[model samples]
Target: MAPKEEVWNPSVETVTPVITLSFYFYPTSTTGVVIQREGFAFSYSEEFEQSEWVAYSLSSLDFSNRNFNRPFFIEDPKVKSRSADWRNYKKSGYDKGHLCPAGDRKSSYKAFEETFYTSNISPQLHEFNDGVWNRLEQKVRYWAKKYDGLYVVTGGVLSDNLKSIGEENVAVPNYFYKILMTKDGKKMIGFLVPHEDSEKALYEFVMDVNTIEKMTGIDFFPKLPDAVENKMEKSNDYKEWSF
Candidate 1:
């Protein structure tokens, strides 16, 4: 199950890091390159035609409480491999899933629009996209509102020789992972959800950062002092985030 062909790139263009993150937290990738965007930073796996991870911060102020007209998904000119055509998703019976969800950027129209970039999306099962996955996103918003702010990194779990869709060969991941931590890094929680729809409580999917790193091979908060990173990554309690 060899990954698809991708040229080696040591780096990609610059974008600002979230408050809890520094350049050091950026995941290591040779085939998957990093790109910073208005609201998030992600490593693009051209091999899978999707992002390996997308990281961002959500603040109470990030929500304007305005109705935003959703926009069309468009190709990201910034992506050198060129982002997948939105057409690949047409009639594919999958949602053009967002890595950086548009709702999180409702603070500004432009911010919301920026999320429409194709590079920010992947194929997702419709039931999953609108079901438990959607509920998890809402929980993130609630946590951000409660704690004032949070740093989050999320993406699908990629494996070799996976199934793909459309003419572009976009990969469909079996599972998705999201890690949430407070601004001061007091508490951290992680979740792994199957790509298909599920009725189980979100808490059922809770995991430790250690497990996510092991599964994805991406160091989450490397910029934290070694001691702090070690302690935080080792904790897996979801009760601290009780809503």
Candidate 2:
């Protein structure tokens, strides 16, 4: 389901934290339990034992160029259904791949550390995580820098009877997908990538957001007007984004 738009009046007294402004771009969550964090928000899938999708804004101001020592993955306190354990990936021959990449959160130590939470990870091949996926992430950083900022949503395509790993039987998705758009919702792009390592250029995986929505049953960018949303979601034009 598309996220319901929340109108917050700053003058109104409220005890709860406001949802991040970026939440406007969140996709539909099939498995439910959407968790909000200071740095990002994600819809956790109890059935898959991982986030179905992680949504965050990448801002040019967020790249602080600071390096931090990696931290151990831990269960997300916000997830009502306990997130999968980091140990599940132990000797499982799959890397604990990050959905919201650590590199994107270097603006603060807390933001960087939040990416280590177990709910933010999925199983991935070593080469795939370090190679093609990494490449796509770098390209995103480039776009974020060029365009000032972007709303990004990413996750594996979770489904039934897939090869699973870990004591919790963490599902290893056959494919992963990412969608990005400017804050104004004028430009958009999506990529659906195979699970294994690949030498193919990143653009080769370029897909329209509508196709991905059909494949994953997620309604991306519901806040856009129907005219704009329909047109943007139907495009696979690589020229819109600079490589």
Measured by lDDT, the strongest candidate is 2
Model 2: which ten-residue window has the lowest total lDDT?
10-19
Q: What is candidate 2's CA lDDT for residue 91?
A: 98
lDDT of each: 0.80, 0.85
Best by TM-score: 2
lDDT string for model 2 (186-243, tens) is 6899999999989999999999999999888889777667888899999999897998
Flag regions of model 2 displaced more than 4 Å.
1-21
TM-scores of all predicted structures: 0.88, 0.91
**lDDT value, candidate 1, whole model:** 0.80
Model 2 clash tally?
A: 0
